[model samples]
Target: MIETVENRPQPKAAPLVVHVVRQFLPNRGGLEDVVANLARQTLKRGYRVRVVTLDSLFTTPDDKLPALETIDGIEVVRIPWTGSSRYPLAPQVFRHIGDADLIHVHAIDFFFDALAWSRLLHRKPMIVTTHGGFFHTKKFLAIKKVWFRTLTRLSAMAYRRVVCCSASDLNQFIQIVPDGIAIENGADIGKFADAASRRPERRIVTLGRFSVNKRLDHLLDAMTALAKRDAGWHLDILGAESDLDAADVRREIAVRSLEKSVSLMISPDNQTIRDVIAKASLFASASEYEGFGLVALEAMSAGLQPVLNSNEAYRVLAGRHEAIALADFTKPDAAADAIEDAYRKVATEGSALRESLMQAAHAYSWDAVAERYIDLYRSIEITI
Candidate 1:
């Protein structure tokens, strides 16, 4: 059994720590959430955790850096980057990380940072977590994929340990670096449970940024088909929309005449998103690929059935259970069939499904996931 940080007493001496990432502080993505939770849990275990991140989308120049702040008893240091891109070449970041016992880099796309830190701060044990590459076929063209693959390969070689959020993500890295570790992602089950109880109505909801890879269009298409068959069906999409794709989605919705059936709401607070998922009759994701599908786990914990693609991440995280209604997107009738099946089952056997899903969801609490990371950290020989 995995021992959680809460189960073990804290060590008297504070362990030095540094977390390097492309972006942090105010970022809304999964990587930011993981780093924040890790910092907090490590601090709870009596370790000093400092974060070094580029002032990208989330952070601003007005944002103070080297400014020490405590979150859940952990000390965090937010830093600014001089480069234009989020993954900038900042040599100064390594300067702040020198005194730390271990330096954990959030994503491998920060190639320059990974290369510089590994070479300059050789004394520290460097761990890299590959949070999925931007080179997925759906997102990148042929030329872009080659460039990203090369960059990721170099970064993987420099890191002491490679960590992936799911086995699918680990498998992706294994093609480049075979000796990587698969660390399952976790969520706060209590918060999700609360959200579920407060949900608004029996509706279908999907949460993610409006991107091509997310296959939001496919979701709308599926909803359109469902509406033709059953006029009562409704779908809600909640996510941040890029100006480039917003027009396309709008055009597609109008063309399909799905304006009445599907509602598009832009990015909302985490609690608001959770509330939406909780009240939803079914949680649907049409992504072509996923590193871990954190949203699916969140929805399942809230007793909402997830309609996800039959991918390794979903298979491993969700397990071989009917709790998660798995669908193969490649199949012609997969989405429509799965949606109908899930809706019908939810109506007839809702209580039983919720109970089983809630039970399975218990395995993914933050405390349990944090313990796994701490165990990995302990197992590693930290020379610094």
Candidate 2:
């Protein structure tokens, strides 16, 4: 005779999401910014958030920061980094991933294999968010050839979900992996939004890490041309020198004799950035590659007209906005012309343009993004 069996009920705890990235906190980048914002928003939605990252010895100096700590209501664990900065090794990463209810890994790197290993052994639901192209670049082609097999294996078997920050980014990622979901990055609109009417000061501002892709050289050429037409306007390029040396940028400024017309504010604090952007007449970016231009959105939200380089991603995001002036940044004359046009638009329709920019920014709220992520998490199957 068969015996009747009773079903047992299991207790559920608060959902814990562990976000793994190459670097976090103190080390600032577009990837780092997105993770921090999403983590905070996730916490607000009644979920516990934790960030696992490597201690960046190359990018940031050792400040004696604690290995394990909490930042903005999210628990953070920084494992010591070994090997070259281009390819860091973090053996301690395994210890952290097993405890997470759901795992979200970021970027395309050696550590991707670590996450993939954890996924296989722990049998946890995993998501991998590829910020953008890491393989297509000229510098990384050799490395890509060597690691292509491993990368493909991880993409195939590592994660349940694959996410990209932009539609353009998604298209690039899909060339390597068959499927991906586009989840655009967001800016802190409230922090950048200005309530008062904007009065432009004939000043332009741009912010981004110093890298070849940023094309600061091209921007300087455009500024030189702009200075020839109008000496009244000045440009401020504010940001950390990550990939490109600061000396090289200064040398370019000297060659163009744009010392007075252009200046570099290296690595200013967050408040200083807000203050500078708030007073700027125009905001600009000459970046040849952007996963998602969060800084451009921030500048727009702050009521500054944006003069952006022509690209599929920016063009898509700009969406025929009369406020965004697009130009081929490779050509100095073209870039200068676009900047002038954007400046005139701001001068003529300041309040109206500001309103339109705010409307665009409102559509990319972090709260909305958080809700989407929470829904994604709840839908995924996780073992208690």
Candidate 3:
């Protein structure tokens, strides 16, 4: 059995740590999962946890969320916001976090800038986690670069700690804050620990948001190549629609005549996802960008070998973890070749590789990452 967060003795005075993010639950992506897992870890450390988020999801603005609610034992308060989702402006965060001992700003967006600018009024020790530093895409990148150096540089001064979630992020952020530290985004690895088959099949499974940056088109083409080679090769795509429309992906699957071999599941529950992946032996993704490639890591934790896009984070992870394979996702044959090679190894050395993959993922388990955050919180208490 995996060792979970140890139930530490409760503090005499539980300090509140409020997480400020652009969007939370009802949106199941990396940022949301990262914050939710951290909240759970802190709560286990005897800390009072709360989430302050926007009332509307940028994906579906017309659908409004509750103003207040509790999820997984964490209190959440939703605040209204306006402006582009890239940098949503929500000033109402001040009202919900007046009593917080520490304000944990997630991602590099408006919440990050807003709390940093109002440091004097809140007077809370703030720490910001750079979730890929908000440069996921190259659109308007010139303006983003200017903003990062100027306004973002000034905001870094207010943060007690600049927690860069990956080494890639560390390289980008350390220029602004010399003391920036690297922390692996903690994953609920145990949820699907050793969930894949002992002697797995040729089925390929990938899950996450169907964001354009994920390069779903490339993934479809890769699947097309695999299907042409062998009608037996199957692909399971499990994800919710983000900026990319679900209908577009479905239409592409039909256009490529891959509906027979490729299966798609939208926003499945935790158990449902686990069940689907359990039947598959290999995992693959064509994502061109990632904060830390948490889904790929999560799949690794499940004893599934990953064939990932050659993005910086995936390249670094593939470097550190031998179980992962990197491929040129833009080239469909290259991606298909990588996927085929991974399955070949899975068939030949499935049990040994599965164990090795699971062992490697344990290093990034929530049990370890959360301990790092708890230590940081304790250190901050002294200065508070």
Say which candidate scores most in lDDT: 3
Span of 10 residues, lowest total lDDT, candidate 2: 3-12
TM-scores of the candidates in the order shown: 0.83, 0.90, 0.95
What candidate 1 gets wrong by more than 4 Å, as runs, is: 1-13, 58-91, 111-113, 116-122, 138-151, 197-202, 241-252, 330-333
Best by TM-score: 3
Order of candidate numbers by TM-score, starting with the best: 3, 2, 1
Displacement of the residue 1 alpha carbon in candidate 3, Å: 25
Ranking of all candidate structures by their lDDT, best first: 3, 2, 1
Clashing pairs in 2: none
Give the per-residue lDDT of model 3 (tens digit) for 1-384: 544433333354789999999889978988999999999888887898889999988778888999998787688899999899878888898998888898899999888888888899889999989999878888889999999999999999999999999989998998888999999898778878888877758898999988888888898899999988999889899988888767988998999988899999988988988898889998988888888889988999999999999999999999999879999989999999999999899988868898899988888888889999989988898899
Model 3: worst 10 consecutive residues (lDDT sum): 3-12
Give the per-residue lDDT of model 2 (tens digit) for 1-384: 442111111113767899988778776567788899998887766677779888653545455457887786678898887786666788888888776788888877766666676554777788877776474245777767556545654554667777778888777667656767878887888876773236856789998778788888889999988888989978898887677767878898899999999888877777787777766878888887788888888777888788888877788777746567788999999999888888778788878888888787777888888787787788774443
Q: Compared with the true structure, what per-residue lDDT tens digits does model 1 show for residues 219-328?
A: 77787778888887788787765322456777878998988888777657777777666557788888776777877876777888788876666776557555788786
